[model samples]
Target chain A: MTILVKIFGDLRKKIEGYNISDALPLNLQIESNGIDTIADILNKFSIEKEETYHLFVNGTYSGYNKKVKDGDRVGLFPKNMSLLYKWYFERNEDE
Target chain B: MAKRILRVDMTKLEANFENFPADFAALGGRALTSTIVAKEVDPLCHPLGASNKLVFAPGLVTGTKAPTSGRISVGGKSPLTGGIKEANAGTTFAQKLGRMRIAAIVVEGKHEEDDYYLLKVTNDGTEFIKANKWSNKGLYDVYKELYKEFGDKVSISGVGIAAEIRGAASGICFNDPEGLPSRYAGRGGLGAVMASKGLKFIVVDETGAPGVEILNEEAFNMGVKKLTNALTSHDVTKPGGALNSYGTCVLVNIINEAGGLPQRNFSSGQDDRSEKVSGEVKAEEIKKRGGVRPHFCSPGCVIQCSEVWTKPGGKDPVGVLEFESVWALGPNCSIYDLDVIGELNRTCNDLGLDTIEAGDLLGVAMEGGLLEFGDGKGALKMLNEIKNKTPTGRILANGTAFTAQAFGVTRVPVVKGQGLPAYDPRAIKGIGVTYATTPQGADHTAGYAIATEIMGVGGTADPKDTNKSDLSRNLQLATAAIDAAGYCLFIAFAILDIPEGLEGVVDTLNGVLGASLTVNDVAGYGQQIIDTERAFNKAAGFTEKDDRLPEFFLKEPLPPHNEVFNVSDEELDKVWGT
Candidate 1:
């Protein structure tokens, strides 16, 4: 499964060897095994769970446990880049 | 130098200083402004008529060394919403008002003639100067001329051509740190209210003025220390933080990713082209072009999210393209180019138009077949029409709902006659609740639910859940308190997360008032402010039906999510238990 991962804010610099796409969503295509959750993807990129604040799976705010599928679009934002923290965190708890 | 109220009677052409009412000692910022407006102004009075009074008040801790506390609230019966309105901006003008020990400046009665006057305030006294010479000019040039004539040490608040014409979209402009007419109380058409009084500008010179009095110096210092620590230490507000690095526009990509960034006049939710105008791009452009990032709108703001956007090589500066401004002027119109957005923002600043309302107006104009979507030049031309005061421009200047009606656009996104800000209600349901229920009309800051949850003021509710009433109501209450305290809303992010930071806010208020106030009393104080506003709005004939999103928001499904605003009317009414 090919999952397109996008990094934003200060999180772009935190990832090793990831080319920072200036002013654009930094897109990194990773071959995922479909079984990999967002947390697994974070681990794969050496990004700590705490470092990632707002996680979106295919444009909908998702949790770390949400499993990735083929052609899934995942976005990760750092804690400092937090915009809608309540909605993201509270919505996740409900799910 | 006790706190006093400067009452300018435009009808009599006289200004007088009155002793501040002891009953209002605990009130400041939005609380004081709203309270004064409610008490004095008749609710059913025509918003742009002689009966409407404009009140400006600085926050309680504004002039003191409270980090990021420089804010001023402008309150009046809104020409846009036909309801009580309080719009605030962060500027040195607020600090000047605070330092001068002026609790509020009430401009009452309308000038009988068409002639405009400037109110010059100093430590000594107040004087009125005939300001007919500066009427109908762009604020950028006018600000420069005003600073030159009045000297560089003064803080100015003025109206532009839009206000002169009594446009409902007009906003009161204030000087930024660089003395650019960039900062604005830019919502609810307060500028028209100010202009209705035949007032063009209020220039405050605070030289030799006593600073804000701290009644309990020790407690004040301790509170200041705690707040400063929280602001500096928080990852979001600290130096090199997300805001400092990218400014508020950082939310462009984030909101876009969440499929909530309104695109092409709310026709869709997300667009790939939104990246072209993202904060990251703007920040990089600012760095390369010798523009300023991490700049403070007012002095002593630790979370300096403001930036100066200039042309290549930094020729002309349009102070700080905020997140809402960028989104409203950029993607909402399907114009993604930063340069075009910059010019549009500059024009809005110059013309004294709220960018959010103006953008929404242009969107409806395009939808009504007045122009093609993404026609940046066409948008500029329409703004020029406003500057020229053409009939078409006049229609557009009355704000989103009026423009939408004029153009026969049915998919109007507004609540209570005011234009909705950047967030689409269909996607961000919580903010939608705020947009619908807030007395201010579609203001996101009125109940920023994010900070509310973190502050633990409102117990949590799932965004997907229908019961977001508690979330919105609690947030509004807490926000009212913060607005009254005069701290920047950005401070809420830190204070909510850090318990000591929230306590710090209460401590500063107690220190200033020399009254004992605990953290538990924050919501109660906020409730009093909200109750005053609610009473005023109720007296103005606002009903539960007024607290509603447009029918289109409930009927039309936003893209990506393909979700309508499904929160029932009962749930929405339950927001205020109406």
Candidate 2:
């Protein structure tokens, strides 16, 4: 299955080969194995699911283990963007 | 000395100290200002007249070492909405007022003559000065001149030429941390109210004054510690949080992506060009230009989300370009250039106009075919009209709804006569309820349902939920209390999620006043403040009919999700009732 990953805020710098200045939600298409969760997808990208980052699947927040189907939209934000989203998520200080 | 009230009568050219009345002893900030205005000012009187009184008050916790508590509430009958108004700003003026043990400054009685005066205050006493030398000057120049005359230790609250011309959108400008006249109680035409009294500026010098008296020093310290911990730990209010990194304009992308960004005068929701003026770009630009990204508007602000945006080569520093200001001047006006937006924002500060209202007016003017969309130069030209007081400028200065009416355009997005801020009510239903039902008239801060509806501050509510009146009500009640405490509204980001932070707020108030106020009492206190403002509005002839969004919000379906404001009128009425 193939899914779209959008990185926003400071994490945009982490998305290799993406221009941080070129608009926002720096997009990249990722091919994934069957029924991959958000965590699995980030793992594939070599992106650690750090405590500072918030994951949003489609417009709502999604946990790392939440399953993603084909063409699922995912947004990853740093601590700053997570704070900006004001999305209610427990902070995992162990990051 | 007991807390005092300074009454300045422009008509008599006299400044005198009056004993703080016992009835207002417990009241502070908006709670005191609204109570005084409701009791003294005639509701039906013209807002920019002698019958209307302008009140300045620091919140109960203002002068203490309380983090982000340096907010001042300026209240009066609004010339913009013709209703009770309290617009707040983060400035050292409030800290000075609080340290001096001055509960409130009530400016009443219009000047019979055509001269302007400045009210200067020190710990010793207050004096009125003839300010004719700085007449008709922009606040930037006025602040610089006043700074030179009084030294940098003084805090200034002044008006620009727009206020002198009685522009309905004019707001009282205050000096920021850098002594620039940028921070403002920038809503409801309170500057016009001040200018109507023939007062040009207020200088507060708190040197040699004892700081605010804390009744329970230990309790206050504990409370401050708790709040500070919560603020520093929270992802939002932390030192290097999103707000600190990029300022409030960070929301430009989030809201734009949600299809609720209100573009080109609410004609559309999403604008691809929005990212050009967004926080991501803004932060990058500020860094590239060697500007201060994480700046404080006032002293003791833990959440330094404010910024000082300097021009290329770090030459001229512009004031903070807030998210709403960016939205108003950028996406809403279809002008995507940050440079243009910053210029327009500076014009608003210089002219003492509300940036939100000024931006809304430009959009409305565009909708009325006065300017072309995306024409940044044209928008600047329109603002120049207000500065130059051209006939067109005069009409535009009155604000969005009035400009729409003058142009015979019916698609004005306003409630209770004040223009809507950045949010589109149709796409975000919870805030729509707030925009409709709040006493302050289309004000987003009045009941920022966006916190929950979009940002998930307190609890995530479906933005499209009409039954979330309970959420709006709870937030509104708590917000009133926060406003009364003189804490910056940003503190809500921490306190709403961290229960201890809210308790800390209550503790600070209790320690300040020597009262046994529980956390539960906050809601009730907020309710009382709202009830007071509502009663004033009702007395001023507002009805259930007045607590409504413009007709187009209900009738027109916004794009993307194609949602209309689905909240029933009954649900909106239930906001105050509950």
Best by TM-score: 1
Point out the worst 10-residue segment of candidate 1 chain B by lDDT.
Answer: B449-458
Model 1 ranges off by over 4 Å:
A15-21, A84-90, A93-95, B449-458, B461-466
Give me the iRMSD of candidate 2, please.
Answer: 5.4
Q: What tens-digit string does per-residue lDDT give for candidate 2 at B151-232?
A: 9999999998888889889999999989988899999999999999999999999988888989898788888988888788
lDDT of 2 by residue, A43-69 (tens): 766677674356666544456777777
- What CAPRI grade goes to candidate 2? acceptable
Error of 2 at A40 (Å): 5.7
Model 1, range A1-95, lDDT digits (tens) per residue? Answer: 58899888778887776666565767888887744688888888788988877888877788888877889889998888885435423334222
Candidate 1 at residue B168, lDDT? 94
Model 1's CAPRI class is medium
DockQ for candidate 2, please give it: 0.27
> Model 1, range B352-388, lDDT digits (tens) per residue?
9988899999999999989999999999999999999
